[model samples]
Target: MVVSSGPLNPKTASYEFNGISGVLGITFGLPLLCVVLNQMIRPDFYIVGLFTNLDIAELWNHIKPLKWYLTNKELWTYYLTWFGVLALFDVLLPGNTIDGVELRDGTKLPYKINGIALTSTLLATLTVRWQLTKGEMPELQYLYENQTDLCIITVIFAFVMAFFLYAASFIPLAHKNGKETRERILSVSGNTGNPVYDWFIGRELNPRLGPLDLKLFCELRPGLLLWFLINVACLHHHYLATGEVNNAILFVTLAQGFYVFDGVLNEEGCLTMMDITTDGFGYMLAFGDLALVPFTYSLQARYLSVSPITLSRPYLAFLSSTMALGYYIFHSANKQKSDFRQGKLPHLKSIDTKRGTKLLCDGWWGISQHMNYFGDWLISLSWCLATGFQTPLTYYYSLYFAALLVHRQQRDEHLCKIKYGDDWHRYESEVPYKIVPYVY
Candidate 1:
C-alpha cells in the first residue's frame, strides 16, 4: 500500500490535495509575473489588454493599404526569419536551461531569480513584431455597407487582447526556470526537496500510456475557450452572413481544434514528456502556453477566405489524402514507440542488444533516430497544405512547426549527448537522419 502526505478528507479515503500553496500560486503568482514582466519589458502595448472601444482614428492606426498587400509576404518572412534564428540559437547555444545544469538523475536543477533580463528583451521584440503585423484591411462588406456587427468585432478584439495578456503571464516562468536552475546548482535537495509539479494540474498521480501524457485541462482549456469564441463569435456569424458552407474549412477547423483538445487532456503523453517530467510546472507549461497554443489558433485564415490554391472539392481530395497519410505516419510512429517502450514483439530483439546503447540502433529508432518527429512534420505539412496555396501566410504555421520540431530535435540531441555521451553518438551513428529519413 502507498503512504501519502497531506490531509485526508473526512468522508473519502483520498488525500485533500488542495492547499494554500496552490491558491496562493494563482493568486499572487499570476499578478506578480505580470507585474514583473510589465516592469522589465514595459511593453507599450499589451496584446490582449482591453482599452475603450477603438474609434476610427484608433482603428486607422492599424490600417495600412500598403501593409495589407505586404501582410501576405511579410508574415511568412518573419516566421521563417524567426525560425532560422531559433534554429541557430538551438544549435549554437545547444543548452536550453537558461541557467540550470543537468543532474546525474537527468532532472533539471532550478534556480530562484528576481528577474531575467534576456526574457525581457525577447518579449519586447516579439511584442513589437506582433503589433506591426496586426495590420489587415477590414472586410469589403464591412467597409462599404457597415454591415458587420460591432459586437462580433468587439468580441474578436477582446479575445485577442485577453489571449495576449494570459500568454504574457507565462513570461515570468522563464525567469523562474533561470532562477530554479541556479538554486538547483547551489542548494542541496535536503534543504528543499519539493518535487516539481507537472505542467497541468493533477499531473503527478496520473497513469500514462504514451507521449500523449499531458493533462487535458492544462492543454485543452485555452483551446476550448477559443473554440467557443470562434464558433459563437466568428464561425456562426460568418455562416449566417454567407449562406454557403465550406466543408473543407469546417473539417480542418474542427480537426485541428480537436487535436489541440486531445493533447491538452492527455497530460501524461506529450512529445516532450521526457523533458516536462524532468522540469518544474512553470517550465513545463511556459513553452506550450506562450507558443504552441497561440500559434495554432493564429493559423486560422478562415476569417479571410484566404487560400494558396482554389478551395474546391478536387483540391480537398488531395488535402484529405495528405491529412490521412500524415495521420497514419504519426499514429504508426507513436504506436511503434509505445510498443517498444512496453518491451514487446520484434523490438524486443532490438532492446536485447549486447551493449545497451546498441538498442537505439535498431527498430523505429534505427530508421531515423527520430522517426516520430518525421511523422510529426508530415502531419504538420499535411495540415498546412489543406489550407490551399493562395497566401504565403497559410504556410507559415507548417513552416514554423517544422522549424520548431527541428529546433526541439536538436535540443533533444544535445541533451542526449550530455545524458548518454558516447552511447548517443553510437546510436546516432547507427541511425543517421535526425528527422526525415535520408533527406534531412
Candidate 2:
C-alpha cells in the first residue's frame, strides 16, 4: 500500500509491497501512453474515420496538420515566452498573496492570486496579434497546428522538472539558518524509500527554489492558458480549413472558455484542494497538469476543428443551458464551502463536528456532499453533446471524468471517516448523497 501522509507526518514512508503498485502502474500507463502516441502520430487515427466515409486523399490531407505539432522548433521557443511571462504575470499582475490551509507545522503557504488578470492578458494579446496580422491570423493558428509538438515538449519538461525536484529535495536548504536538517530538506511524503514510486508519485509535499514555487507554475500557467489558446486556434483552424466556422464548435468554445475563466478567477479555491493541501508534486501531477489536461480535455475542440458538427439552435441552446447550470452550481457550491471555511456566511450555521472542523449540512451541501462535482460532470456532458454522437472518442472525457469523480468522492469519504470517525457518519447523514442529488 502507498501511504499519503499529512503535513504533520513525514511526506512519504516506505511500504514493503511497493513493487505491486509499481508493476500495476506500469501495466496501466504503457497502454495509455501508446494510445496517446498513436493519436499524435497517425492523423487518421484520433477521432477520424469513425463517422465519415474514407478516402485516401482525405487521409493524406489530414496528415498535413500533424506535421506542425510533430516537428516544429518554433513551437518549442514559445515555452520560454509562456513560462517566463506567466511567472511575471503571477507577480506583477493584480491580486494579493493569500494564505493556504494550515500545515502540520501550523504554517500556511502563501499563493499569489491573479489568474483573472493573467487570463485577460493572454486573451487580449492573442486578439491584438490576430487583428494586427498581415493577411490571416497565423500565430495562434500556427500554435494550434503545432499544439501536439508543444504538448510533447511540455511532457518532456514535466519529466525533467520532476527529476529536478527529486534532486533538489536531497539538496540542503540555504545555510543561512546554520542548522540543516535532512527532514527539513524533504516533504512529508517524499522520503518513501522506493525511488520509482517516489519519482512517479512524488516525495515532496511542496518543493520550491527560493521564492519561486514549482507546483503553482505547473498547475495554473501552461496547461490552462494553452487550453484556452487551443480552443480559439480550433475556431480559427476550422475557418481556415473549411472557410466556415461551425456553430457547435463556437458553443463548445464558449462553454470551455467559461470553465477555464472560472478556474482561473476562483483559483483561491485551489488553496484547499488535494493538489495543494495533501498531494506532492510528482509524475502524476507533472504530466497531468502539463500535458494530459491541455491536450485531452480540449479534444472536443480538436475534433470539431477537423470535422465540424453543426447543431440546431435548440440543441445549441440546450448545451448552453447545461453548461450554464453546471457553472452556477459549481460556483455557488464552491463559494458556499469557501465562505464557511474562511469564517464568513453568518446566515448559514455549521454543524459542529467532534474533530473541531465544521460540517456544511444546510444550503447546497444539503443537496449532495460533492455538489460541485455533479455540476462539473454536467459541463463535461455538454462538451460531448457539442460534438454530437458521431464517435465515442468525443465522449471519452465525460466517461473518464465521471469515474474519476466517483472514485475521488469515495476516497474523501474514507478519509473523513478516519479523521472524524462517528462524527463523519453524522455529517454523512446530514448531507446524504456523495455527488448526485438523489440518483447517485
Candidate 3:
C-alpha cells in the first residue's frame, strides 16, 4: 500500500479496471484465496505435496466440515468489541490536527494524528490485561485457535461496512434554503454509474462520521494493530506448544511488529498517500485493510507457530540483511518523495512537468519509478524466507505482494501518462526504470 504521493489529478482518478468481470473476480476471488491459503498452511497439510499427490478423499473430508469454520460467536464478539474500542479511542484521544492535501473543491480536511499515542495506550492496556489475568486471558489463545473464524468475521464485517458506506453516499445534506444537497464527494474513477462496480470501487472519496475519517481510521488503526496482536498471539501459541519460542517465530513477530509501530508513528504520511488522496473508500479497500492485511500478512508467524523452524546463523544473517535493506530503501525513498513534494528538496534534480508539478529524477526515484515498491516486496520476501522452504503457501505474501505492487505501478504510470502526457514520457526516459533500476 506504500506509494508515492502524486498531485490530486481528478482526471487521472478512475476505476482501476474497465469492466465488471475484473471487479467481480477480485471481489469473490480474494476471500476464497484467503480461506484456501489459511487452510493449506496448516501443520497437517503439505500444500506443495498436495499438487502431486492429489488427495481428493482427504481434501473432501477436510472440506466437509466447513460448517465448523463458520460457527464462532465468541470470535465475532471479540472482533466487534476490539473494533468498537479502537473507534472510541480514535475519537477520544487527543492529537495534533493536521490538514490533508487540498481536494478538488479547494478545501483541505483536517485529520487527527494521534496514532502513536493510541497505539501506546492500547498496547499498555493489553499488556496490563494479560499480566493481571496471569495468561488466562481467553482472547490470547482464542485468537490463534479460531483465526479462520476471525478472518471470516472480518471479511463479513468489511462487506457490511462497504454496503453501509455505499448507502450513506446517497443521503442528502439539508440546506438552509429548503434545498437538499449531498455533501458526499464522489470519486471520479469510482462514479461508474453501476451500483455493484461503484460499491466495489468505493463511491465516496472520504466517508466520515463527524471528525472521524472512517477510511483513514480503518487504514491505520484496527487492522494494523490487530496484525501485531495476531503475531503476538502466534508467538504465545508457539511457546505453549513447544516449551520455548523459536528464532524464526521471534524474528517474524518482531519484524512485523516494528513495521506496524513505525507506520503508526508516522501516521501523518498516509494523509497524502494515494488511498486518501485519490481512491474512493470502497469494499476493495475495506476488505484489504481489514481481512487481507492482518490475517494474510501475519501468515509467516502463524505458520511458524504450527511448524516451528529454527534458523541457522547464516540464514538469520541473510534474512536480517534482506529486511534491513528493504526498510532502508523503503523509508528513504518515501521520505525523499515526501520532502520533494513539500518543496524541501528544491536542489534535487527533477523534471518540471507541463502540469506545474516536478517529477523527481534523482535520489531513489532516479533508481526506479517505484523503488519503494521493490523495497516493500523485498521486506515481504524476508518474512516468507524466515519460514524456510518448508511450504510454498508461506511464500504467498511475497508472491501476492509482488503482483499487487506491479498492478499498482501500472496504475500509477497510466495515471501519470494521462496527466503529464509528454512531460511524463520525458521523465520516464530520463529515469529509464520502473522499480528495479537496470534489472527492470
User: For residues 1-440, what per-residue lDDT tens digits would candidate 2 score against the true structure?
Assistant: 22235544453544322454853475357334523532532345545544464343443443336456446566666876777777777777887788877766556668878877787888788778877885377777667766655765676667777788777666655556768644433444456766766776667777876655677767877788778778888888878778886898888888888787777877887878877776678776778887777777888888887777779989888988888898889888988998887788767856788757788887888889999999889989999989887677778789879988997787577667877888888887777789999987
Taken over the whole model, the C-alpha lDDT of each candidate is 0.41, 0.73, 0.83
Residues 191-244 of candidate 3 have per-residue lDDT tens digits of 767899889988889988876899999999899988998999899887777779
Instruction: Please say which candidate is ahead in lDDT: 1 or 3.
Output: 3
- Give TM per candidate: 0.50, 0.85, 0.92
Where model 2 places Cα greater than 4 Å from the true spot, the runs are 1-8, 11-75, 175-191, 346-350
| lDDT of each residue in 159-264, candidate 1, tens digit only | 3433343333233322335654211111111112222222222222122112122222233333333332232223333444565445645656655654544443
* Residue 273 local lDDT, model 1: 53
TM-score of 1: 0.50
Clashes per candidate (backbone, < 3 Å) = 30, 6, 1
Q: Whose lDDT is greatest here? A: 3
Predicted structure with the largest TM-score when compared to the true one: 3
Please state every model's RMSD to the true fold in angstroms. Answer: 18.0, 4.8, 3.9
A best-first ranking of the candidates according to their lDDT comes to: 3, 2, 1
Residue 193 of model 3, lDDT score:
76
Question: What overall lDDT, based on C-alpha atoms, would model 3 receive against the true structure?
Answer: 0.83
